[model samples]
Target chain A: MTDMLPTGATIGILGGGQLGRMLSVAASRLGFKTHIFEPGANPPAGQVADRVTTAGYDDIAALEAFADSVDVITYEFENIPTTALDALEAHKPIRPGREALRVSQDRLTEKDFLSGLGLKVAPYANVESPDDMASAVAQIGAPSILKTRRFGYDGKGQARLKSGADADAALVDMQGAPAVLEGFVTFTHEVSVIAARGIGGDVACFDPGQNVHKDGILDTTTVPANLTASQRMDAVLLAANILNALDYVGVMGVELFVTQQGLIVNEIAPRVHNSGHWTQQGCTIDQFEQHIRAVAGWPLGDGSRYADVVMENLIGDDMDRVPEITREGNASLHLYGKADTKPGRKMGHVNRITPRQN
Target chain B: MTDMLPTGATIGILGGGQLGRMLSVAASRLGFKTHIFEPGANPPAGQVADRVTTAGYDDIAALEAFADSVDVITYEFENIPTTALDALEAHKPIRPGREALRVSQDRLTEKDFLSGLGLKVAPYANVESPDDMASAVAQIGAPSILKTRRFGYDGKGQARLKSGADADAALVDMQGAPAVLEGFVTFTHEVSVIAARGIGGDVACFDPGQNVHKDGILDTTTVPANLTASQRMDAVLLAANILNALDYVGVMGVELFVTQQGLIVNEIAPRVHNSGHWTQQGCTIDQFEQHIRAVAGWPLGDGSRYADVVMENLIGDDMDRVPEITREGNASLHLYGKADTKPGRKMGHVNRITPRQN
Candidate 1:
């Protein structure tokens, strides 16, 4: 039973967002039940999960009870509170492990880890105070992005440094939080490799998907991305290198910037990523199920691409287009049951699949 | 809201079986919440449904509460008690309606309805007692089946009549229940069409699938079923005819017997059928989602087959083969989180997908 979770075993999830919702559905497919722990009432994942603890991560008692009820623990987001992890890990194993989370929870640690593994990453310098920002700007030069070292997502908590004069203004954006000044790497496009590592240390990566972002949020991801044969291999190999370096178990989203020199590591997330949502229609096994299999100690599934797909996020008013999308052939819609639709919120996504081009 | 259920609407499901489990997952994809009503403790569907009411259909108070919570209602199985429908329909609209349940609940009524619509049906006669059994055997001839008109599924409540001399013995198997004596139709292979009709009366049907039954239970269903061009067309047309005649607003599985002369109607299930499970991998929108869409008052989705699939049921001890199946490339395992596998029980199924042949 330790080698793999038996059928009907409960998998504890730390977040109850759309990723957790999809993961719960995938776990159910493999005969595994999911228990979601979220502070928010009526979280989307709670609608599909077997059990939900509507207590915040700071509530140690609720966290312990949730951990005790599940056989294994995984998460939808990487930035889990440290105290919550300490309480849960004592009862059950947290998959993708603490090391993967440690490396990914901060932009600085992730870049350093990727670079230490001899993988290409954009040049960066740590920034803390105004003095640190001045030095980082001098080292990295203008046209660099200042991103907070921790707790930043969907392009929040960051400011662009167009010139050295903008450094103080950018530092103000961080609000005294530690930051990283990353030198911009001129790239043709952004692509992400959704990779998984089994408990047995076996690695599998889905085809890279070219992505487009609108207002700092992912707009669409098209599979069979424009990559040379060598670039594709490099992208997968670099992802596997990162996973192996961390001794990672479960899926990791490896975002890469396709540059003239090579595929530069942008960042990594130690759970299912939005760009990989295309696998729901492009492959036999989706990223959510792949993550579940790894965390549950099952062999990684085949990640072969079987269809050409373009996954588009349904943000806010994009939901108004649902009726039209419902009528469109080849478009598969996945909507998160959120009560309110606000601008920039991810309501869901649609995967438009077509016959494979190659 | 009258034309189509808005996202976040609750769909009340009548039964909590594997069909309900899959339907709940499908409903979640469309941002719909599901409330499952099952008498049994820890029903498989409860693992994924948004809510569960553990009460029998005879509990009028519980049924009314469930119906009040949902915007629409549907069932996984057709043989819902009349009293349950009476309580539920008064609260929320039940898609596929009571007409479908009435026609399909009794075999004699179903056969007559098909024949009445100019559809070919196996020769059949009603049986109420020993005298009726003798007359049925005389009229339908030898090599027939005696089936209880109600509560029959998975080859249950049935006995074979090999000859006139076996009439009394087959009557004993009925145990005084109303029955149907049906002459077996000579056929090459059995096929079924998974059809759906929208609230607006538009119809869509998935490609026919060839079925193989072992121990009176479906073993496997292969898409691109060996049907000639004309036989395939006839299969879909007959299925649409039934839905149109019944004014059905959900998915229906129409089992057809392919004879040398033509396609003959066997029976129709007013919900997603096991034989249609192959569509999970072979079609853009599987039958479960198709049923949800129709019941939710949305337009029918694309049911076009995208891959060749062989859906194999994992029954009883076949659960032992799950580890091996999980490793098989192009195979998608869907296990019902049912504890304790006994002989002749359905544990789950796997869809092995391959490129479409034609």
Candidate 2:
């Protein structure tokens, strides 16, 4: 049942954003055609995809047709509607499986699963009602965060709690959605492990990259993140354990907080993450190709880092600096081909190769 | 008039083979869309391009429409029909210009142009008639080659002359077409420089790569070709002189023969050469991207190579070994997404990274 997809097979991707765009290019590299299902017209991925279905996920007929045309189904984003997945999964296999999506869709479930596996996570509790919120505050205390359990990204759908008295205001930020209250874990910095699990249960992890965020968005990711040998080993091992627990079958991004006591798991994304973009220049085989290989059931590639690289996202107004960036030596520019430049929009990224420190 | 193409502009490619396919991917990396014009249905480039026109080159109306749809025109192969170029050039800028095409279209003109620039070339004479063939034989002697002046590649339209008595047989191979009789020269090995010229007249050349051909098709290209520093500088300078003389804007492949005398110019290709494919693994900027940058009027990327690489072409039954190749570590596989693999057809190529020797 784990037969690999043959060359010339069409892989259906659910979202047609920049991640999907890079994945489409990587799929073409391996002699596979890609069919993109994007709701927006002229999606960034559609320009490179072999075919695109410009229909909403609610259009079950379109989803079924998209599934029927491809050998397997994979996604760029994890917030896919349940009905769309149900329809598509009926026709073809969706890699990373429903179990991964089920475990990662809710913050409460993901935290519980990681903790159950003997991994350290930020202290948290459910905030469903007024009494529950008070009990959560009493248990976890103030200086925490109230985050909706699902569909939150890039600092959206989140509110910070200054003290126990601020619980009501923070709950208001949830806007009636199920929420999780997380106590702040003191950490020096953040790092992420880009890991992949093949169909035959083989796991591989790229070296951790240190991430720095600005205004709740990823600004830059630097490889060879300052870490002791033991910390790096622990990061890879915990990421592997999570993938094994979920029986995952594609690349997963495990964000970890580096602390004096130990590394704490912050979050796990089912699809490729922004922090892994550096692999495009640092490794022979990048994260997008790694995910495609796992989903296609092919043998994994060598993910070893050969150079020091810094990947910086070009968001919004950064497009104006393209002409200057194009002249910078050793900088690899990758533009998203988006039509408009809206503030806070991820325009593209540039990977700058730097000399390795011995 | 020398202005850079803004992001979101379309680049129209004239041929839709593997080279065009890779070019389209590179163009997309720089935020430009690609439209491929090819007579064949479902060309390999079309699978990744934003648009594809499936009309013959003789269709002037289609050519005009394609030109109108793009900001500039470039190509993968050099054998484009003149009438098509006439129509497309009327609507948009055709990069590399007509002078380049005129000089490279015929073997006689190419040889004359190179020798005119004081570059070393094989001794040759025109053979348009029986009397001319006799004089060419007398002047060049036996153990030579008689090749048609136009549309010859991969050892086609060529015949060997073992002796003066075999001149008639070699002429017969040309089928009464205009031909050239060339005297052979002894060389140690063959090397090629993949060089590019920007709109601003800036020239950059990748390191020479040693080439080995099998059955007249390029089999392998190894970087860091064995050459003294003086020989390397001579190769690059000679290539730059040719581009400068022609005012060429795009990447060109300059094939050279290494002999006891010096490097001899074997031939020049107006498009990216197979020998330059190793740059995909060895350098920060590859030949395809360098070509795109030149055509788009942008500054050329850093052409400096940082790693040792060997590129091997996969022809015919080589597709059968893809599974084994995929499992090999450090081997970067680039399949052309070709649907059929016929004998002698280029299905794809693989670039293997090796340790750099001091």
Candidate 3:
């Protein structure tokens, strides 16, 4: 039957963070159970999920056991080790596949894949060694960001090089790994299109929201972002093409750089994303539930927005303001159970929904 | 600092049904863990919760351990034995308390309590024995019901006395137990108010919805309830008064019968009610989350309805329609993990959100 995931069907998810926690909540709403496997210290997802296996990323035995328990498997984030994927894929259906992982895990491959899709990306050069770094610096010039080709997340594992003299230290910092020096682009704004694609190839997108970062961490996202109507349409169209191209089945957060010419793809998160948190109070379906529905092979839910939204992350001590934030009638507070409130950690968030009905 | 219950807090839930399941889901959302203590062989809440302790209803040792691990306690259904509650109350904070449970679990007590609050109730009489039943039958007459004073639910342990001959058999069927015989009132419609009150005495009521029952099981609930403005005001007033009287701290569903005389109080559910499931898709705060917020000592949410709604339960084999039900653009489906779907068992429910602004 169409959009019917049989009862007792299990959905395996990789990465056990807030994304997985929210995903598990959504999966339960649709009659599917989520089994989360994450190699971390009691990830939040473990709390709400039906089952969880805490094993290191390269632990093939645990990965295989996890894969065997579920009907379909999806990941909360890119950068899952290829070996882990190889083992999981052998036993379960992994949506978005090795190709989506291969491309999005590294900036260089991501750019190349997008470029292959005839999308515009910033100029770049690979730095394999000091010699290659020197030549790559000569080609890409000053003010380029030298980034390790893998394992970088949330602005970590990269160094911005303003001159050639810093090349040696940058390469040494990267520890003899292959890297890319990408030319900096002057962009109008940073925005992301949080979208989902069903296995049957239907795609739905939330309107692009302007994102602002503080110290390389997402600080806030406001809907009705400073984009022309055409730009919004362009973002959805581009996201749908990529989802179909990769045959991706799940919600993806497509970060894009809005330039004067058009939108340039930034990166893609193959799960429910932070930027779409507004959906919790602003839309017919939240991104996490939407993602679960897609991966469970269920029909995509209505993605219509009911309100103009402003979402602010409750970082570290900001969680202390939860009582105050939630006291406002318009705010929808969501807290992720993190034990320690260390600085810069995303402890929770609040979405203030103001209906645009008037 | 205000509502944060320390880390590793275990929230103990008494009844392990879907309300508990959904509550566990919300509790998990806030980083709080759950331990489901149930007497049933299998509890739907146990499927997604962190821990489950299955034992007899009167097992004091099991109840004690369940309470020991939990920071705060709550129950899904109102029928917790007073002895079991006494054991639990010795260890943890049981929100809504034994008084509320005692009042709601017995139809006689519930009706009496509402009547004491000056709320309108159907004419009623207590039947403690067959002789008491006969005397009450003389007063209440035919077309009334004889309900066991305790441990009755979903039309179980209740019998309709259509005539004097049936009255003796009804009391005999009631098995010499304490019972309540009520005069039947002709009603134009049935409705219920799903509301919550916080420890601080904050009261929030969702608009009452008209309910329809098939074979004594709730079949559907439509919000706006076809109640006139005065009727809606009366329903909310009755609900608020009930919460205040009980000093209740959680979501409660108060069923009402609207007759030519006015709205008559039917019964109350001390926890999330099936009739209130529409809140998931209709309101900013669903009953499950509203109950959590109340028990957690947080401020009550707005409980704002975003749209008109209709909720249908997927009882027993009715769950087979999930595929077709979910395909509707507006319905939100919720299913429990029951290994076997038996006749008369509630497997799940679906909420249909009608197209309207909040």
Name the best candidate (by DockQ).
1
Binned by DockQ into CAPRI classes (incorrect, acceptable, medium, high), candidate 1 is medium
lDDT of 3: 0.83
How many angstroms is residue A85 displaced in model 1 relative to the true structure, after the best TM-score fit?
1.2
Q: Model 2: residues >4 Å from true position, as ranges?
A: none
Cα error of candidate 1 at position A34, Å: 0.7
lDDT per residue, candidate 2, B237-314, as tens digits?
999999999999999999999999999999899998889999988877899999999999999997988788989999
DockQ, all candidates in order = 0.79, 0.71, 0.53
- Residues forming the 10-long window of minimal summed lDDT in candidate 1 chain A: A1-10
Look at candidate 2 and tell me the lDDT of residue B271.
92
* Candidate 1 runs further than 4 Å off: none
Instruction: Choose the strongest candidate by TM-score.
Output: 1
Q: Could you give candidate 2's per-residue lDDT for residues A256-277 as a string of tens digits?
A: 9999989999999999999999
What TM-score does candidate 2 reach? 0.99
Error of 1 at A193 (Å): 0.3
Report RMSD (Å) for each prediction in the order shown: 0.9, 1.3, 2.0
Off by over 4 Å in 3: A2-4, A163-169, B1-8
When summed lDDT is taken over every stretch of 10 residues in candidate 1 chain B, the lowest stretch is: B1-10
- Residue pairs with backbone atoms closer than 3 Å in model 3 (clashes): none
